[model samples]
Target: MTAPLWGAVPLQADEWRFGLWAPSAADVALRLDGTLHPMTRGPDGAWQVSCPARANLPYMFRVDGTDYPDPASRLQVDGPEGPSLTVDPSQFDWGSHWQGRPFEEAVIFELHIGTFTTEGTFEAATHRLADLAAMGVTVIELMPVSQFSGARGWGYDGVLIRAPQPDYGSPDAMRTFVRTAQELGMAVLLDLVMNHFGPFGNLLPAYVPEMFSDRATPWGAAIDFARPQVQAFFHEAAMGWLHDYRLDGFRFDAVHQIRDGRDQKVMRDLARDLRASAPDRPLHLICEDERNLPSLRENGYDAEWNDDWHNALHVALTGEHQGYYSRFANAPFDHLARAMARGQVDEGQPSPEEPRGAPSAHLPWTAFINSNLTHDQVGNRAHGERLISLVGETPARVIHAALLLMPFVPMLFMGEEEGSTAPFHFFCDPPDDDSCEAVRKGRRAELAGIGYEVDGMLDPCGEAAFDVSRPYPAEDADRAAAWRDLTRRLIDLRMAHIVPLLRSGKIGDGTVSRPTARSFDAAWRFEGGTLRVCLALGTPLGAVEGTPIFTMGDLARDAFALHVEITS
Candidate 1:
């Protein structure tokens, strides 16, 4: 096994130079545009070839006299098994934009294009760009648009890495989606899964068996990043998205499952290469890892979705301690208090479940608090209970306000802003029985630990899950207005004061004090020169108590202490 070529520049541009370590193959040829370009075998057991004028040419690879698709093709027109297309990055007309927002300042909005709107297409989703921009969202993080087996999917099961899903419209539609978002001053973040491919319609194995490693993940053995050829495959895949699609950043899904026993981490190598390749462009790497934060920081990721904050906040607000929320039931307010101020909750203590030493001491984490309406939380549940259903509207609104006010980068799932009454059920459209069975078994096994029955959850093969997850349009004008007002005010507060104070590290000790009788209700108060207080009244009460009186006694003589409720 050869060591990874860290930050190695490609041989040349336009002329595609390809290399793969395949000692087992007797012969190798680079197939492009119905032509075979014979690859020369190097002394290191690595096959190399450079095809002249290969830009914008459709191509594939043949190993040991048998044809196979390029595992790391830049443009896959059909499925992963289909012929590869060499797309010229310069062909697209980027209208008057060359820069993206810094990772720290970005307010990311994660959305599934198929479910975000009534029309499940990129062009239709583009129409909502103004709404996202109006909500102060700086980045629209799309859950993988890559072509899968069928019409509808969550995108994690995508087999075609390069091609945009045809159901979500064509390649032009995706380009328009990005262009529209860019025109609206919002950078586009694409979610990429380098860890593993779905079972359905994947043709990668037909070409290179080494693509799937001997190592195992929860899903299955993923692409072998430690292997020399596998490393090259993934590196090129990462660069391809940046160069071909012009994606601003990538949200690596389930990166913890990317098994590599090599000395150099594949993620670190990818990050290093991406930075070296496009030093000017903003390339944010966000991971969804349940492990300690040190791995993410040391591996050079911009941010990791801080689920610890979410878990703690969920338990605090709803008192639902099932599944993984069990570990955070007795967690002190100081955990959340510190996270609000410092961006991490498990900074010091060892996780109750994981045997890891302890989480990273301090790291900036995107805080997702008190919002249980996310796909993972809702769909994974037995009954698919929405947040409003589990916790009443009053408590839900209070929790939502607290989440927005929290110091870390806040993200709202689709329909979450308006108190979306609709449930986000787990959905997929697998083409075959084998793929469908794999999905059903996988989801069932994952939920079994939480005491949820497989039969209870929506089947990935069924059309019910896909249909149930769709958003319900706002019927009541009052509810719609309330949601709009709440979001606008929260966003304004974040921009005006909370973010600045958090950045400066000036916001000191704060507490969400709640009346003993009404524990679900709470008030957040910041202690400083100018006292800022935000109260959430969950229940209708004649009188509410608790006020912090300073020694200065700045209150006016005639001014009596009164509860102030700001409702639109």
Candidate 2:
């Protein structure tokens, strides 16, 4: 593993090497435990200092005059704005050589670490690994755990790219959680935000203004990816996570917002390097791109989050076509039919927003990850309501069944399987009242634009909001049992039937037909067999001959069914 371009690097048990790229700073000094040591500017304009130190020592860089935490801090043991702590990666003893599961066999479970358990710590989450593995989840996708402001926020506001949030646990505890999951036959993928830094606690712009472009993203200043130093900063951050934590992969957040003008895009370079770094490991890289770009999958990415599938399915199931849902509201069933048959619903098609997407039908079905409920779909609402709450259990169950049974990879948000109605709200703990007010105002405007009742919306910056976001099992025991049973059956069937066919990564494209606006039949053919699914939202369709591994609702009315056949 190569040394990172920034942050404090522990060279020996009693010696530390600190490096910072601050082109704008005329002078730089390291404040390691109250003593100031001047950093010498290298030929490349980077400031470097080597000093006697040990692990857990608090340090900060005095750039020109103002002190700032290490931009590539490994452990912000305090909050994001506090001093950085030196950590030795060799401290954690990974007991076994755990190779990850293949992307084709993935049954991803995306969860937020803070709300995963009442304790909201990595050690607490470790205890639940067996339960997830037993549920047949092949991958556990954690939302960003990067150090952000205050005690909480969806990890997207991460200022320190490499540091694990101290609120969750120490860096070693995080490693333990990952290793435990891997031991239980589940690969762990971390959600990474590389597009822009958070609004607060980011001191990079103050010392290294050249790292950012004149343009800005929705979050903050746009990253100047064209610069070699800027590219190295992000590349090293991601690589450190992959190597140090033994993480299986990453889900790059909001890639559509990442605009790299260079001929060799930074994302592509990062993916290539990550896979090369661990050629023996099954490293999967996924993207959350709105453009529906196929090159990402064609290049080095394994798959992209198919929000098109969720949007179309949500509209068809809930009949609520506000905000982004309006694009599919006109003919959601048809859009869904396209999404299942091909890959993207917006494949070079016009939309209410803009002319979105490129041709995606040529891509393999597994290249798209489909889900009924995700953090974005739930938390972005005026009231974070799960699909079970929106259209009732029967309909939600059917949609979930259809999603899992599809040839595409399936992902479930944290509490969907148990029929938990706990609201996954957009909660955060801002550093101060001014930041709190800013969050409140922005959240209100966002909800109001979505045709929601903004006045009754929960305050995002309040502790009450965070409390409500912690998920719990369903209140009704019977309903919860039924939901769990159905989920287990569906995933079992997927593992047994769908997973084998996907192993070759040569899945035949699905053919879908809509008999009525409320019903559809879809099937995909692999080398050895054909997998079929029939779904009806508000009405019944003709049932297939064979008995389905999973069935929900009345087959004569609104229902979902799955059937499979093998050929010599």
Clashing pairs in 2: none
lDDT for each residue of candidate 1 in 1-568, tens digit (9 for 90 to 100): 3333211123455565665556667888877788888988877567777767445566766787776655545456565566766655556776776687765456667788888888888888998889878877777788887777777788887776656776788565687788888888788888887778876777666545667877777656667777766666667667767776677878888777776786347888888878778788777777777664566556667777777667766666677777887777765344455444445566545557654324443444332222334667776776566777766676666556656655456667777777877877777777678778987887788777676666767776788777777665656779967887777776766666555544443323333443322222222232322223333222222344345321111122111111322111
Best prediction by lDDT:
2
Q: Per-residue lDDT tens digits of candidate 2, residues 29-117? A: 99999999999997777899999998888999999899989998999758777798988898799998997788878899999999999
How does each model score on TM-score? Answer: 0.82, 0.96
All candidates' lDDT scores?
0.64, 0.85
**Root-mean-square deviation per candidate:** 5.8, 1.8
Off by over 4 Å in 1: 1-21, 44-46, 52-57, 262-264, 331-342, 348-352, 355-361, 364-373, 441-449, 453-456, 472-474, 503-568
lDDT (0-100) at residue 332 of candidate 1? Answer: 36
Least well predicted 10-residue stretch by lDDT in candidate 1? 550-559
